[model samples]
Every structure is written in C-alpha cells, then in structure tokens.
Target: MSSTSKPSSSENIVAQKFDRCLADLIVKSGVGFSAGVIASVILFRRRAWPVALGTGFGAGMAYADCDRSFNPARIPGTRIIPASELKKDGSS
Candidate 1:
C-alpha cells in the first residue's frame, strides 16, 4: 500500500502567502527602479544636475531593495557563522 500524503490546507495557504509576498516585492521594486532611471534620464536631458543625481540614487536604492527582497541571505537578523566555528576536517 502506498502511503503518500497530501499537503495540509494550512501548508497550502502559507505557500500561497509566500508566493504573493514575493510577487508583490518584485513588482514594486522593479517599477520603482525603472521609474527612477527614466526620471534620471529625463532630468539629465534638461541639464538638471541635482534632480538627475537624486533619481540615480533612488534607482540604486531600488535595486538593493529588489536584491534583499528575493535573497533570504540578505535579510536582517540572519547570523553569519564565523570561519572559526568550522572543524579542522572542513565540516561546520
């Protein structure tokens, strides 16, 4: 007899929530960065140095936002185990 089990309702709900969060983050960050770049280019064409610089900075910040959103390692409260904690046999 096979004993394969289906996922619980709670598990499916949690997975859906995670997927939605990821999708929202990607869309928001991507739109923010694209808008910044576009504004920067427009300001640059108008010879507005301060506005151009501000938009460029915003674009960079948006890029970082996207990176952190998708990569769990970039999340805060995550600890990095020191190399000294490793065993001489190359195992953690």
Candidate 2:
C-alpha cells in the first residue's frame, strides 16, 4: 500500500468555510479602514485632532480584528496595505 496521507472530508469542508469567511472579513475591513482614513484626513485638515486620531485608531483596530478573525492562521504583524496599491491610476 502507498504511504500517502489525505485530508479528511471534514477538514476540507472546514478549510473552505474558513477561506470564505476570511475573504469576506478582509474585504469588509479594508473598505472600512479606507473610509476611516479618508474621514480622518478631512478632519485633520479641519484642525480636528481628536476626530482624526479617533478615526485612525478605529481603522487600526478594524485591521487587527480582520487579521485575527481568520481560522487556522494568525497574521504575524499588523495588516496595513499601503494606499498606493489601491490607487485607480495604478501609479505607485
């Protein structure tokens, strides 16, 4: 007999579910953080330090939450994708 090991059916199902959940959370958290940053920038321009700081902190927390929400994994560091990657013009 061959000595190969295969993942059980339940393991495959669990992996699929976890992947779907992770994708959804990533999208949601990314959007939320983007909106928060934009709002914070506007507030900063208006000389509202409190509002700006609060919004920035919220964005960081959201990112942390998304990183931890995934199963069978832990993001080693903070997830802060640079805004340049999200630009429409694709100019970095």
Candidate 3:
C-alpha cells in the first residue's frame, strides 16, 4: 500500500500542474481574444488578423510558461544538482 501510494502522490502533483496550465491557457487566451475584438472594432476596421494574432500570442506565452514550469533546467543560470551530491548532502 505504501509503495502504491508513493506513485499516486507524484501522479497527483502532475495532474494538478496540468489543470493549472489548462486554466491559465483558457484565461489568457480569452483575454487576448477580447482585446483583439475591441481592437478590431475600433482600430482594425473589422479585420481578422488582430484576432488571430492575439490568440497566437496568448497561446505562445502560455506554452512558454508551461514549458518553464515542467523543465526548470531550461532556465538560464539554474544549478542542477547531481543525484550523488543530493545523497551525500542528505537534502530533500
């Protein structure tokens, strides 16, 4: 039971992260779409490009953020500790 629960706990964390990412994507994309609609009516003269551009920009930002969250080492100047060092240092 203990062994089974350990993997389940890690899976739960992954599920939570995925849920957060999905929520962020929806919210950011919705805001961008609203902004685009406003701009289209006022500035673009009912053009479609602004709407598409805004959606892509929002999605791209969300993707970047999600990638960063999943891969901490991808960020610049992040120190990656080796497994051996972690064991030696006795750090969690």
Candidate 2 lDDT by residue in tens digits, 67-87: 566432575665655687668
Stretches of model 2 off by over 4 angstroms after superposition: 1-8, 44-92
Taking the tens digit of each residue's C-alpha lDDT, what string does model 1 give over 1-92? 45997656977866766676666556655666566567667755644554545555655665666566556588889986767766654863
- Model 1 regions more than 4 Å off: 1-8, 44-92
> Can you give the TM-score per candidate against the true fold?
0.40, 0.39, 0.79
Clashing pairs in 2: none
Residue 11 in model 3: lDDT: 80
Better of 2 and 3 by TM-score: 3
Best by lDDT: 3
**CA lDDT, every model vs. true structure:** 0.63, 0.61, 0.85
Query: What is the C-alpha lDDT profile of model 3 across 1-92, one tens digit per residue?
Result: 35455445878878888888899899888888888888899999999989988887888888888888888898889999999998988965
Error of 2 at 44 (Å): 4.2
